[model samples]
Target: MITLTLVGIGSGNPEHLTLQAVRALNDADLILIPEKGKAKDELAQVRREICANVLTSDVHIQGFDLPIRNEAITDYDARVNDWHDRIAVIWKQQIDAHLPDGGKVAFLVWGDPSLYDSTLRIADRIQANMPLDVKVIPGITSIQTLTAAHAIPVNTINGPFVVTTGRRLRDEGLPAGIENVIVMLDGECSFTGLNPDGLHIYWTAYAGMEGEINLSGPLSEITDEIIATRKAAREDRGWVMDIYMLVRSTP
Candidate 1:
């Protein structure tokens, strides 16, 4: 039986790691780090760095190439389903190769696994094919970090809020009956799709990492600046992870 621990490492900040997560890291016999190809190796590096700092056991670290999501497939749901299956196979292959006897294996997840992440789903797929037990160690999310950095509560007094992705916000427009929206998993500035009038935007790139950028003001005033800055930052870093919140007052 394979005991899989999906450990949340938080937003690339060692300070955000929970005590439980640290313990899980130390207890694991083998850790799998997914390489999102060479361009996104920084992600794998973060896991390596985190393990280096917190791991107390003689845990073996292994890097596996992550399956690329097929954007050219045109069918979004089918594409994702296929990708998840591919990832599950890769995980099984790595686990079988490293720990033939079945030991404590871990994966460093970005953000809390329960929130808008597919790691759990992939794990479920793995469990379907093999005898496995799964556990998750929670970590601080970019949403929490974003709100904390802005020093504001997520919602207004007696008001509703929605947490969604950039694509959802852009495609669906502002959700009904909610004045505040926290958007993540966005490569494009989904905020630009909205009517800039009467909207207050708070944007943060690399929320917990070094060289973090925070920009806020009326959407109309700072929209262009945010776009230009976001573009320049992505070009400079070759990759960028960002989240933002938009709050509109009840008029």
Candidate 2:
């Protein structure tokens, strides 16, 4: 039986690895790190650094080129599904080639697997091809890290919030009657599209890491600053993983 573990290593911070995550990495027969091309090479390098920092034992680590999503498909859902299918094929091929005898293999996921990440879905695709059992080790989410960085609470007293994506915010707008919002995977800084009345924003780039950049203020006043800071962060680091929380009339 092949046991596949998805270990969340937290948001680009090697020290964020839990003791369980460390043990899982060291115990794996093989670990696969996906290279997202030169534009996002730092992402792959961060994974390697995590392994180097933890693994007390000799563990096999391999790098694979992740397949790009087919943009020509013209449909968002179809393109993403097709891309995932292609990625599953690559993952199976890599696993079979490296650990043919059927042993434990692991993949390091950024943030908790239960969140917005698609790694769990991709793993479901792999399971259909062969006998496998999946295990997840949770790590600190950027949402948690973001709130921690600002020393602010995620929710107002007895109030609910929505955790959403940049695409959704752009397409659907904010949820009705929701006072607190945490937005992730937003390349466009989507909040600028909404009414900034009474909205206070807590924003952070590289939320959990030592080199994080944080910004906060009335959304109306700081919208331009946030956009400029975002551009600079991505330009300087070659990539940006950021999240922001919005509170309307905070307590």
Give the clashing pairs for model 2. Answer: none
Residue-level lDDT tens digits of model 1 in 107-180:
99998999889999999999999999999999899999898998988998998889999889889999988889
Per-candidate clashes come to 0, 0
- How displaced is residue 204 in candidate 2, in Å? 0.6
How high is the CA lDDT of each candidate model? Answer: 0.89, 0.89
The RMSD (Cα, Å) of candidate 1 is 1.5
RMSD of each: 1.5, 1.2
- State the RMSD for candidate 2: 1.2
Model 2 residue 69 distance off true place after TM-score fit, in angstroms:
0.8
Worst 10 residues of 2 by lDDT: 36-45
Off by over 4 Å in 2: none
Report the lDDT tens digits of candidate 2 across residue range 112-177: 898998888999999998998999999989998899889998887899999999999999988889
Q: What lDDT would candidate 2 get against the real structure?
A: 0.89
